[model samples]
Target: MGLTQTQKAMVEKARAAGGSGQAIPLSDDACVCLIGIIARDLGLSDHFPELPSDLPPFFDQREPGSLNISGVEFLPLMERLVKLNPDSDTFFSCLANLHKRRLKYERILQTQPIPTIEQVGPRGLLQFGTISATTLTGLLFWRKWFFDIDNRAGQETGYLFEPIIAHAIGGVPFSAKASPVRRAGDSRKGRQVDCIRQQKAYEFKIRVTIASSGQGRWQEELDFPVDCRQSRYTPVLVVLDATPNPKLDQLEAAFLRQQGEVYKGESAWEHLESVAGPTMGLFLEKYVRDPIQALLNKVSDCLPEFVARMDKDGITLSVAGESMLIRRTLGAADDEVQELPDDASDQIPGP
Candidate 1:
């Protein structure tokens, strides 16, 4: 169906009128920041039925805080979007072409140009700069499975050990959507292997942590992937800002070493060759840097120098940013700091 001439004109009119309510025009960076946040808020689902119009008022806040609109309650939501660009990119990148079902509009639109993940899972890999946390959260959210452990029995060290074990046996624990098969028994001990491996499996050597503050005797734990015996499953590692308690990273590392030692003669169970970089910092950096950088480039009137300062640490744009940051970091290791700049202290504030 094609958009009726009347409908097309109406949409154009609405879009044109979209900014008139703006008391002050948003910077290019600000606009993109707004869109990113808006997209995320929409994704959250608690606040439903959002339209383009809901954003201008939020963007209109020109407060002297970390962001262009520090007074706005939605600033944190916006910041999360900025901080999770790679995840956001991966998400938008995965979306297919836009389609409208209206009988009035006949145009079948191709997806907007977004970066593509050439190889993901195992053969395909992608990077998350400052947006590491966001990317991980997004990966979990997108796949319908966040990193959940068995806190009930506390037997699995309060983390999901089954999936970790599966990672050892050429199985990949993807977000649920990426799972090859979904059955009633996925959460079970033995069933996970069959369900995960039945589809294409990619291994993520994630730096995982477990806290004992809330649960049982597992004081703290950190685990890192040290073996890729199951390379047939896509293999990648997710590094975090700090090591978890009980030295899970060391444990996994030792496990790999032990495996190598044990199977040295029998078969190859070698660790992966790391293409090292600033893993944790870059992840957070991408979260804010990419959005601020790109957004500044967009607004004709936006000062790049001004937006650059927004990336500075120890800054909080709005109360919302503060609260949301706290929520996201709730279960994370205490040592991991929110590296993304919340306060644009150097920019002389926004409004």
Candidate 2:
């Protein structure tokens, strides 16, 4: 939060130039950091959660470049920010400055988190305080859906997690439009590299462990590096989990073979945020990682007292001394049970 190295250098430059009464110059990152500090001091972070966290990197010197935002760019942002305020209570110039500050924020959200969540659909509301029957249902519902939906749909939606971080770090879905370097298996279905940006091909994994997976998938993973190198791209691997595994070691070797880079666990997060720049960096921290961690921490505090069971009958949820059996019908997914009376349960049943 204090002056960053870049800011310090600029300060020294300003001091030297002060005798001539010349205007002090601020680098793009330094200017952004000052704004963030000002917002924090003014306690405006609640209005813009991405404020302080997003601004740190600029000060940290991770993002060093000219921030060329012309009026062409400013107009769209001004229009959007203006729309947010229906009331015109002394906010003409304020909105302009506000949008200038939050330039990358809305775009990052629109391009990243919003789309990822849309696939998951809405999580039903939870009423806090006492453990209500409805609250328990929400917990049981997600856990049940995770397994049941996975088995039925034959999809691992957790794979969606990788793209979230990759895109946050400026990598986009591997497409001819996104990058010129396409890997051997660049088809939409048999996607090889997780994403690509500039001349780097990225492979993102939540974790890599000793546990064995499909040989075909392992082969594809191995092939990714070779394919990327062939396309004149550097294959970079990012794994979020640090759990040590021989398989992970092997995978690292694969990337090393291609003269690529590997980042795991804390380093992976650091690499991602550093590359994400200010706007997308905040998006990763605020909307993505922080929320996920908070969710886990919240759940860990008082774990949900809910259970889900799937049988030939169907899926059933039992929580708060109540049971709801969703019976499955032929050619339709449940589609199963009640364990006890609903005397103390909240009246949240679909019926």
* Highest lDDT scorer: 2
Q: After superposition, how far is residue 278 of candidate 1 from its true place, in Å?
A: 12
The top-ranked prediction according to TM-score is 2
Give per-residue CA lDDT, model 1, range 103-155, as digits (tens): 00111001111122332233223344545655644453323211111111232
The C-alpha lDDT values of all candidates are: 0.27, 0.48
Residue 102 displacement in candidate 2 (angstroms): 25
Question: What lDDT tens digits, residue by residue, belong to model 2 across residues 170-264?
Answer: 45544333444555665333333566678888887767867667888788778778778878889899887767888899999999999999999
Model 1 stretches astray by more than 4 angstroms: 1-173, 176-231, 234-236, 254-284, 288-351
Clashes of 2: 8
List the candidate 2 regions with Cα displacement exceeding 4 Å. Answer: 1-148, 151-160, 175-191, 291-306, 309-351
RMSD of 1: 22.2
Q: What is the lDDT of candidate 2?
A: 0.48
Task: Spell out the clash pairs found in candidate 2.
Answer: 314-336, 315-336, 325-336, 325-337, 326-335, 326-336, 327-335, 328-335
